[model samples]
Target: METTAPIVDRWGGGTCPFDAGWKKVMMWSFIITDGLLFAGFLGGYGYARTMATVWPDQSTVFTLPFIAAMTFVLISSSATMASAVWSAQHGQRAVAVRYVWLTLVGAVLFLGMQAYEWTHLIEAGATLSGNPWGDALFGAYFFVTTGFHGSHVLIGAIVLLVLGINLARGRSTTENVEMAGLYWHFVDLVWVFIFTCFYLL
Candidate 1:
């Protein structure tokens, strides 16, 4: 009998020459797939905006300052997530837990800002069907895309919270923290694109 190498070595113990842990490998795979999906969304948004005869000015319709603040908070959270992973890798469990908690706080603030924005927009006559703004599509796409992104943020926060709890209890490893960081970083990166595509240009 002869040993054979598996086509894909997701876990160790196979004949695969290169093997990152399963969690790390899966996280990268997920981020790549998710990135493509966001690309399609942003591409469609760009195409639609381009095809429109009279595209409304994004700045005019959305004048809130909090969204920009939210971006800053999200970017800051990415830093905290990186620190959490680094601390975990170094066996600084307490520091890792604190950093993860900070990241969750950032997420909560971002969600609060989004809720305010949504409420303000709805009060100002923006809806799924239309808006008082020059182009109705602006409101529709803005809500759909932003709401979608918000949902991802919400999910990421919840996952991070769980990872923090597990790490605190010694139920997980540094690899778990690193994997969670990958997902959080991916979500943050996607928001950057979403912000640019849907808000700035």
Candidate 2:
């Protein structure tokens, strides 16, 4: 068996041990694990939908145009997040702060839309304990998936706020900004799937 030696480089000439690159890798690993968990949940959702005597019509049960607008907001936020990362990397702190603010605004808007949707659904007689749409399965899946995604979005927003404060105080480094961006991007990616599966399909 062969052993590999640890790589080293001169100080300031190589990437720091706590660099953006390493943080991005860790974020990717986290996203991959999260994706697997979501996949299983979605598969189970699909199975339940198929097995149910009456599958809820997504188009009828969900407000399509409203969700579509929310989707657009999230996707645009992803773009802003990318710009923030770029600005941070290039040492443009002001631009980075602006982009982070925009991203945070987008997150707030998305959450508001989700709240509206939840309220509307409840008004229409959907409940976690007793589903009014099709069956208990319908309500169960609806709450579990959307609720999980909403929780992620909430966490992402909090992370963005923290990063924003750090940037404003000149305490945030490029690596910190990049790590936050990575987490934000993952949240957006998960929502894309959720929108497609829950609303469009």
lDDT of 1 at 62: 76
Q: How many clashing pairs per prediction, in order?
A: 0, 0
**Model 1, residue 52: C-alpha shift (Å):** 0.9
Candidate 2 lDDT by residue in tens digits, 1-201: 123233444234556655546667788889999889888879988898778798778878887889899999999999999999999999999999999999999999999999999999889988876655676788877888888888999999999999999998999899999889988988888888888888877
Q: Which ten residues in a row are the worst by lDDT in model 2? A: 1-10
lDDT of each: 0.84, 0.87
All candidates: TM-score? 0.88, 0.87
lDDT of 1 by residue, 32-122 (tens): 9878977877777788788877777767677647678989999999999999999998989999999999999998888998898899889
- Work out how many backbone clashes candidate 1 has: 0
